[model samples]
Target: MADLRVELCGVSLKNPVIPASGTFGFGREYNEIYDIARLGAVATKGLTLLPRPGNPVPRIAESRGVILNAVGLQNPGVESFIKNDLEWLRSKTKVIANVAGSTIAEYGEICARLDGLVDFIELNISCPNVKCGGMAFGVRPESIREVTAEAKKNCPHTPLIVKLSPNAESIPLNARAAEEGGADCLSLVNTFTGLAIDIERRRPILANNTGGVSGAGIKPIAVRMVYEAARAVKIPVVGMGGIACAEDAVEFLTAGAAAVQVGTANFGDTRACLKIIEGLNEWCDRHGVSKVSDLTGTLVPNA
Candidate 1:
């Protein structure tokens, strides 16, 4: 059998397949279906310094091969998360606490609180669902650097993973900016800004007007961005967009991602991450690959 263990920013993952944030929640719901510990790590839902009710109704809309959401960052506050879910979740698998904030100060405050608690603190600077502070800090390289630096300053102990926005002017530049600002790892591309309209109603489907589009449809764009960012930065990159299968994950690994996060697909299949993990093991074995980490950056450039 092939070794699926992988190292990201010095932390070891039993496998490279992680259930992306927002989608995985606290891993409690999915734990009933399968042992959540089987996962490389569980990224919690986007948490704020205070609890949020999120955006208005009609937050999720379905289209072909994709879904658009503006669910805001609705969640039980950071303190609540720590008091309620932290320890139980840690017993299952690694925890990547996905956190969001409306300002740099807020980002720092939350990071400071989670400093030595979680295995990793994933900065949700690219969430398009929230109107404030989410994608705002992720649009420009300067903000990306500044916010990341602030978050890193507060989170000196825990590994910080800055989630980059796909809507940025240059994904590579933003990624490099995060690295320069002290991000231990980078993850992209967060959902693309998209609009879905109702013809008869002549109005936007989502209450937030625009939402983040994610699903199988965004894989190619995500892969290209991941490759570009990976090549540009020396830090580990966690690639994700539309990964529902083993072959999909293989593409991201070959593109130079230290690991891949499985999002949207989880809504359609509860065992998506497990299936992909099994598939990766089988695929690697058939290809004579001894370890899955060997798959990273193995793409043929000229081909």
Candidate 2:
């Protein structure tokens, strides 16, 4: 058997498979299906300083190979998470608190509150900056840096991970910017902006009109972007996009992700992360790889 352990930003993960935020929903429902402790870590849904009702209904839509969502970061707020879910989740496995904010100050405040309470603070900078005319903080490298810095400053005791937005103008530049802002780790690519039309009504399928696209259809593009971001940064990168199986996880690791997060795959099969973990063990042994950590950046490019 091969060793599946891998370290992300000095934090040890038994494996490199974490359930992505939003998709896993604090791992409570999934825990009823399987032992979530068997996995690497669980990233909580995007938490804000206060609770949000999220976007209107019909926020989720389905296409052939992917799904679209404009859920709008609905959550019970950071205090609620800390008071209710935090301790229980930490008892099972590493807890990565995914946080978002409407302003840079709010990011700092939330991070300060969650400082040493969680193993890591994953910043979801994709939220619109209400103070800045509703521009997403992750859209620009400058804002990515600013928000990352603010969050990092407040969470000095915990590792700060800047989750990159795929919809940004320059992923590599943004990755570097996050690094420059003192991000201990990084995760990407959040979701690609896409629209689904309901031809029957000649209108949009999702009530939000457009939604973030995710699923198996995004693996190739995500892999390429992960490779680019990883190559451009010294900090560890957590790759996620449309990973559904173990092979998909391996592709991200080899492409330069120190860890991989399973997202939409969780919706298809509740045990997707576990199955991927099992598949990885079998794959490593079959390939004669001793440690899974050795798989990072192992991709051989065609010259």
Write the residue-wise lDDT of candidate 1 on 42-144 in tens digits. Answer: 8899999999998999999999999999989889999999999999999988899999999999999999999999999999999987767999999899999
- TM-score of decoy 2: 0.97
How many residue pairs collide in each prediction?
0, 0
Q: Which parts of model 1 are misplaced by more than 4 Å?
A: none
lDDT of 1: 0.94
Output the worst ten-in-a-row residue range by lDDT, candidate 2.
126-135
Model 2, span 99-195: residue lDDT tens:
9887899989999999999999999886431223123788888888888898898999999999988888888999999999999999998888899
Off by over 4 Å in 2: 127-135
Models 1 onward score TM values of 0.99, 0.97
Error of 1 at 142 (Å): 0.7
